[model samples]
Target: MYRVLPGFHQIQQPNGSYFTVPDRYINLFPFKVDKPFVVQAFDRVMERYVVIKKVVLPDSFLDRQPWKRAQRELFCMLYIQDENVVNMYSAFTPAATREEMTEFYIVREHMQGTMQNLSPPTFGEHRTVKSIFFDICRGVQYLHAMNISHRDLKPENILMTRDGDVKLCDFGHSNMEDPNANTPYIVQRYYRAPEIICETMDNNRTSVDIWSLGCILAELLTGRVLLPGRDHVDQFILMVRFLGNADQLFYSVMNERARNFLNTYREFLENCQPPTDIHSHFPDEVFQGGLSGQPEECRMARDLLFRMLVINPDDRIDILMVLSHPYLAEIWDRNMNPDDIPQPQPPEALRNFFRFQNIFAPETLRDEIFNDLREFGERFNIFTGSKN
Candidate 1:
């Protein structure tokens, strides 16, 4: 029974089970019902506060007979060791009578907001791209140093506190070192390294994570995804374009059966089309792939990002080299001018480029667009190549 301030309150369930009621409630900001939420139910009947969380693991997770337990073990270890990691207070197995029984609740300490929530498009400059990436790098460095590899490191799994610090969560696919064992096949396809995708990363799971790290950095900077693809096939097409054709290692991951499956789709893969012109709002003049930031300070960071997005994981930069590079130095260098830092802005030419003289306007707001163009005047040179 849950201990209340003066007495005990029994929690009755819609199902047959019963539990204790909490003494006090803690508000989880922006809580969603089925998805990750904020409000946490807690009890502090005595001097100590007890918090409970309801976690449900799908039954499908158990279908993978080989890796189900392993995945759980990995998550449990990672969760408990890393305080920055999502904290799980307890867990309960589902009731035995439930059909398709894939439910279990993992009680956890509720964290504040997700990285997506913190860095919403509407939120103005607080943590710049550089700082956000540095924090990520530090977290990654820790994971690598501990010999752990987070197979899926995406923005969705990144949790942010009220103070704005980021914590890497979701270790469901993470891998820990086993000296006697070889690295297992792991990685979320989109963030998947070229080597891993190509099967070249036989034991290089760490590099795969680094590749995702770079993609994440680029997204934070632009507020637009750098390598967005909807599915495995779409992602593969994008990667091949950047990385070229996969090597033997890439083909090695698939069994003959899987290879045969791919062979059937070979014709379709060959016919896939690339975007006519990939639009990067980044001005060509300002972006010198190697010349950005301080040559001695931000070089590693830049090069690593460039490499991570490379079509081939085989050619990607190793995180060790990335961590040692001078480019990363800018992360901690305070002497740099804040004003010199590059901020995300639309191209100068695009600002006032589109001007419609209200010719089609109901004769009302037409003037507003023209007035805006007038205010923009010569300061904004809008260009539409097709208009010519």
Candidate 2:
């Protein structure tokens, strides 16, 4: 069920006494994709556009009290309110005064559009693409310091503002990178990392995001998906053709199911003449004239891409190294030094691998979300100008 109460802010009374202030949000439209409904709501009080993503709790799941499921995702989204990340304005379950509520709503600071909207011919300039990449790295760096993985990173989910500010949104597949738990199908098909597709446990969580970023950066620069695979098998073929095999060790470590896939594609691998050079695939024109075109900056950016688009997860560049890459100096912020940002204590690991299997009851989740905002306040001094 979806509901939008206009001017949720408190209001004044006709009498000398005052009523409630105006509500912070007002619903503009109801959007549906499949069964769940996502609403475009306005923050009447704040004067900002906000998106309310609905998380449905079916009767069967509710029987198990799956609050932890929703909690895990909300926790990840609300965990840190960083500028590079889409801010969670609030989270709550809808309950009428007379009846109990059934589902959850995650309210986010609505963005103008997504990075997908900026694909080439429209905004394919190199500097424009560079800005997009810088923000992505900044967001992932924060998640990595907390020992978390985005699990899913793609253009559609990366929101961008009118001023070129980017916000990484959608932590629906985020996790703490537990070695023990087998990762479900994580990233979207095109952006899926080789390690993730192979189901190799040897790779760490942060590397997965880096790999996805590599794919994203390539698309932003080239105005096309680097590897647009029709399926897992095709994806493997595409990667092998361009990046070459990651390592034989990646094959040995693969789980039985993944190994079987390689066996099926063995003939194709044998016949395929892997290209010796990848430079031709990313032409000089694509990097130079289209992007900033500075010879030194282009050289450094190409080098960074080489490190990120590695076939092996172990070979993938470290997330911190990306921030320091010389190519990014134009957009880099000296105050936001990667060395100065210490790791944060991640939220307590969700006891149940709920995966949004179950989550907080309305009041329970709301209280926790409010606490997140409060924690953000204490940590950043946004409210009292006091930092921890």
TM-score of 1: 0.58
- The number of clashing residue pairs in each candidate reads 19, 18
Q: After superposition, how far is residue 73 of candidate 1 from its true place, in Å?
A: 6.1
**For residues 232-315, what per-residue lDDT tens digits would candidate 2 score against the true structure?**
778878988776655577788788888886988776666665456545556556752346445555566677787888877777
The residue ranges of model 1 lying beyond 4 angstroms of the native Cα positions read 1-30, 33-53, 57-84, 87-110, 120-127, 177-189, 194-204, 257-302, 310-314, 334-388
> All candidates' TM-scores?
0.58, 0.76
lDDT of 1 by residue, 131-157 (tens): 556666656655665455677788767
RMSD of each: 21.9, 7.6
Angstrom error of the Cα, residue 362, model 1: value is 69
Residue 270 CA displacement from its true place in model 2, Å: 4.7
Candidate 2, residue 39: Cα displacement in angstroms equals: 2.4
